[model samples]
Target: MWKMKPSIALSVHFTVLLLTLSSRGSSPAGKETFSWVTLPATANLTWTPCFDTFQCTKLALPLQYSDPEAGEAQIALIMSPSNYSSNDPNYLGSVLFNPGGPGGSGVSFVQELGPYFRAVIGPQYDLIGFDPRGIGQSTPVLSLFKSPPEALEFYSTYPQNVNESISSFGRFYAQANILGKLAVDRYPTIAESVSTAAVATDMLNIAKALGQDKVNYWGVSYGSILGATFAAMFPDNVGRFIIDGVFNSHQWYQGDWSSSLLDTDDALTAVYDACVEAGPSLCALHDKSSDLIRARVNKLIDSLHVAPLAVYDDSDPSNISFGVADYTVIVLQIFQMLYTPFASGQVIFEALAALEQGNASAIWQGSVTMANDVDLATCNFNASQPFVVGFLDISAPIACGDIIADEDRVRTSDEAKSDYQRMADASSTFATTWYPLSEGRCAQWPIKAKDAFNGSFTQNTSTPILLITNTHDPVTPMVGALNMSSGFTGSIVLQQNSTGHTSLSGFSTCTAEAIHAYFANGTLPAVGTLCQTDTRIFENPSNSSGYTGVTITPLKRSAEDYSLGEAARALAGSNFLAKSAGFFGRRW
Candidate 1:
């Protein structure tokens, strides 16, 4: 959501990088000047130091690309510099990044983990992240309720989850329909402008502002979908792009995300195996065999399904408060923890073990949240619930608006049930709890995108992109990378032999080397290349955590030699997933 402004041209030659647009015709014989950062004078793109170590900038882009006159929207951008000036021989260029929440905030992402990402990709190019249109820090925020009280009222009375009980499925389905209608009713203008295609164009504009014709990018999960869309829409503009944790564009644009979780169950199997290898001392859920452990865990969850556990604080004479730890609430935490198993194995197992012993504090404390359950009795009426931002405001529109919606979508209870069952059949592990990520997300979506691309993803870019995927991603699996790579001829699939969401979720020296080599000099690994991650999951560290009671290891390595696994653990405090915090934990 930005309006383009007229700016100076950039020469792609290594000799003279930055140039003026007026002198384009009289430039030196062989140099080709490209029109970059053509922003209006009112919206000049300028950088300033922010967050102590990073450079921050905001660009005004056309609210609607198709109609430049449709006012403008502000895009918040943050960049971690490569520490090399343009004249320095070490300065390559800039790598534009999208952490992938079709609705994720780049400003917050860069603020939190820019150093880690810049270190991983190499120090020659600047790493940049942005909050997509109508997202965090960006103008025209998309939200259903303006304040905390409204959201609290809705969530408090809403179906806790679709899987809370047999009847909850129907209530949750109706609630989603109501939410879609409410969102569109609240923000139709944003709903029309927020799509993957629009974000792709925004990336091109960002690349131009950075004085580069080709965009150097690293996108994860939903970000991968954004990268693929960029390559397909503007093939010649592609520059050393990497789509890690591949989300099949074919599956996404079709309004069908059922196929993406094909490897979630397999990821769980790996987690269980690693637990057995770690022994009972390190892993709380250890068993002689994976099957035995699975049965044990399933039995606990089954019991919760029949009778939910209630946690009550009756210490105060007059005030007794309670919170319920049900099947859906605990499973949602399990499904999210599975995203980074190396870091969450003990967190999950420990909570489960505590629950098995008839204590719900561990799991309930980590999972189901209350605004002020204990203090509700004495709670001031004027005081509101803690305002926690949710991403569904943007994710719903991107997922629902991008697709073609008919009169017969997720409007009815039967349609929602059928869609959910389809997802469960594809991957039974966390389908019920994780259903909000994709399936039933478009229930009664009221608005349609002004511009949507449900076409082929085939592209022949000037520079080929590198596609990376974990062997067993909880959401976007290996098949997605293969399917995405098929359209881009000459593109190579770099497989990281790791269990988690993406290559960053685990530590792999080989994968790091390949990433470094690729960005440093457009180097491509051999066809059928497989990199093994060095992460040792389910291993207890020296110190236990104050929060989860699991042993926690602190990561403080320099960017030059950082471990992706350790970095991931450090980043657990922030929601690294680009889409909804529903799966990844936090909004940013």
Candidate 2:
């Protein structure tokens, strides 16, 4: 039982704060010099001041990194200065922070939580956040879809029945094809297109523009993938890089959706078990330890598949019944909310109890539609879902296909479906559904993959990268972290025994302290060293001090059995197991 101080004791450290503009290298002896080129910032670039008192600067970079001589893209760069800037001589470098979501805006995220960084990292380093290319403040952002309600309608209407699912798949594919064709006709992938590689280059260019030779980066969720890729590409330019919610670049490129889904499922089960073990004193769903929470939860999920529950609209009084898929989406959203216990736990437990009571408004309120405001024209697709599906669907055909003749093309649709089904059967129950959902969207989208996906991490470089992962993260599971650790030779792994998506700012005092020390001193934790987190810091709604209602649940045997049973039923009669057994059997 690892016990630490309560949440309030987690104070924001504000000592030794300093901020200084970078100057040109005077002598060039053990110093680097970068010519400062201050171009006109974009007009559309917007700035919302830091909520906790900080200054923000909007910067512009080329939309396409490869062709800097081409058109420009505007990015919002927010800088939170140290309190003691005038006194300190050795000013720590600017620590760029990214809260993931190739779509998530760093400017707003850090502006809101700037004080938290100041408290944890102290006042030495200036915390800077910039919206990545194709994201907020970055020009020509990816705003393809309509409102959240519209997006939900699109997603919810997806056919769950075999015949409808297949028809829906075709419709989606047609739409994507149309969209892709339009995109290609309108703007070809020139040297300056917005790609992950391009984003890495932009980071380096941003550092150079800021008049800094090396940068300290703190990237969460999707930001982890960006950070790792940047490190892989520009190793020497990395001063201190912390990548939380590890994204396996190999698995990502290879399209290993089934594996990723399994990982997520396992993490969720762990949460469920933890909640059960915490008992009635803590968790609302409290029952006897042997009461089998996972079984009950599964039963509730199955029941929804048949009858569903009508949840009252948060905004309106109208009640709406939700299907199993809707419930699944709610579960995914709750997984993220787990990071903020107080805000999520009560909501999750209440929703669960509601499901038991034939109501589901709590779940609906916290569903993806509500939480992400997904219907917004600015954001239609969730960032992680596409990546997961794309990887698995694209990788199998490429990995197992005859590459010489079919170099660029994937396996035939039928073949790919069969392969996916087989993989799902052998892996997890949700794989069948998840695999299709993940890849199905791409079927309609017109752009063909550049090449057969390969599970290879381009790691010939000598970059000192630091990889941080939570042992029980629901999104980018621990297995993904392990896969990343195995791939990046120069990378250091910091395994925090925490739950949720990111770990750097979301873990216990010791973990957070170690992260601060590493960023501040450029030191890496010992390999295989595990940082214990304070699991007691749940999201307690009753307690005004903590987040609304988030709680941690451990994975237990009953949950595993339930999940396994669900998988077996979902992948019944598909050749899924025969093909996937090779990969999934290793888990046993």
Index of the highest-lDDT prediction = 1
Summarize candidate 1's per-residue lDDT along 393-434 as a digit string, tens digits: 567788788776655544566766777788888776577765
RMSD of 2: 13.6
Q: What is the C-alpha RMSD of each candidate to the true structure, in Å?
A: 11.0, 13.6
Candidate 2 per-residue lDDT over residues 162-225, each given as its tens digit: 2223364455444435434434464443212455556677778777776778868887766776
How many times do residue backbones clash in model 2?
A: 46
Q: Best TM-score goes to which candidate?
A: 1
TM-score of each: 0.84, 0.70
TM-score of 1: 0.84
Tell me the spans in candidate 1 whose CA falls farther than 4 Å from its real position: 1-42, 313-322, 371-388, 405-411, 541-575, 578-580, 583-588
Q: How does each model score on lDDT?
A: 0.66, 0.48
